[model samples]
Target chain A: MWTRIRDFDRMIQAMDLFNSRLGGVFENYQRPRLSAGTWGVTESGPRTNMYDTGENLEIRVEVPGIKKEDLSVKLQGNYLEIRGTRKAENPEGYTAHRVERGETSFTRSFTLPSEVDAGKVEASLKDGILTLILGKAEPAKPKQIVIS
Target chain B: MSERQDVTVREEALSERNRQIPTVAPLVDIVENENEILLFADMPGVDKNNISINIDNGRLALSGVREVKPVGAVIWEEFADVEYRRTFSVPQSIDVAKVNAELKEGVLLLHLPKAESAKPRQIEIKVG
Candidate 1:
């Protein structure tokens, strides 16, 4: 019964989220309407857990058909950029019986805080997921001195 | 016409007794740490060859599709309701370049770390 209640609550929440357009700017700008020959792209962005810590900030994104080599990331001063494109497979041979995939390319960037060193940044890709490691600069590290 | 067909497919799935297929990908979870952030999502039918992630202008986007081909005359249909679509606005503190993504056992995990100067430090204590 509790599980059912929770499921019902989630269903209501999903409906409310779907109907609400408060923070759906992407849907308005990036996503195109569905139709024949629309040639739309799938939507990819921050799935969840977009947070930061006192020492370092962390971000996670979901990208399902793209390869790691095809992705590139760059940091310029206080801004970070992520760019990638996904291509559709050859649909000539098969009837495509059902195509639930959207063929869209995307680029997203974010500004960094003053505390960011902008150096010592490392990234890796495994199993279609990207992970980045940013080391703090020496100046930003905590130090202690004897009081005279 | 295509939209109508999608609706009909969903209706057919609903009419089935054991319809547990998903129209949308499962909710993804993101956990933040001092050096990196971890993301976990359930994507039953998605493969590495089809996932794509983009972060630009404070907007983060995640999209993918699970191609389910109908066999013979489509006696019944479940799953593959529509193409997946989801996006979010990322925090400004992230160092986007140092990000990575991996998919395993139908779950995609992403790691994004902060810039060097952004990471926290431990202050040493001096007892004189």
Candidate 2:
């Protein structure tokens, strides 16, 4: 009986180890068990955050190790599309032991809550993050109504 | 003994759940050569002041924090403020004083040079 109890304890510990190994496997189908990169975004696309203000809409994306020349953006009405490719950064003639930083092509798109002026859109890149400021169209801008 | 083990297991699981900021290990690449070891890590949106590197007793620790501040209301968010943490065990022969690091496009490049005594040397043979 004592031996069986000890076996039970071992089994429990083994199960715990197994669970940890499978960490976040079913959390998101697009995300691998191990993060693709530091961002931990979906494989088909980079992680993105969108915000809406009265005058404009702001969109931020995590795109590390990517060059400005390799990224492209498109805007039409309220639709926005982003495409980029992260080429391998491995230095020539260097032997790699572990390569985990994400280096893959991805395409991501989004629809804004209101129409935006493509001509007035402003985009900037800093520290590998992309920020887009889209000016809302005149008709879409929030308006206040005064009571008489 | 089993009772104590059960308590420890529960405590470990609860600690991560209560953390306000999620912590993740940054993806890295390790390469080595005859002179030094080169390590590259991906850390986007992290400022230079937020990165910390520590080496002690044959262990190296790297950590960085990314803070995201958004204006107005959020429509959808797939990422946010996070803490990047990772550690590695390095050889004691590494020249800690001579170690060099640089950041480019949110990627960190670290060079750990080997001490002169640890570098490989070729011996000469003479006929007597």
Best by lDDT: 2
Q: Write the per-residue lDDT of candidate 2 for residues B23-107, one digit (tens) a residue.
A: 6688889988778889988888888889999998989999888888887899877677777778999898899999988877778
Q: What CAPRI grade goes to candidate 2?
A: acceptable
lDDT of 1 by residue, A21-139 (tens): 33333233443332212222235432312334435554443444556766788887667787766565323332322234434477767765434567767676543445454454556
- How far in Å is the alpha carbon of A82 misplaced in model 2? 0.6
DockQ of each: 0.02, 0.41
Model 1, span B24-110: residue lDDT tens? 434455556676656555564465677788989977777655554333232222223233446766777788998788776445666
Error of 1 at B72 (Å): 51
Question: Candidate 1 lDDT (Cα, whole model)?
Answer: 0.52
> For candidate 1, what is the TM-score?
0.39
Per-residue alpha-carbon lDDT of model 2 for A33-58, expressed as tens digits?
33533344347678888898889999
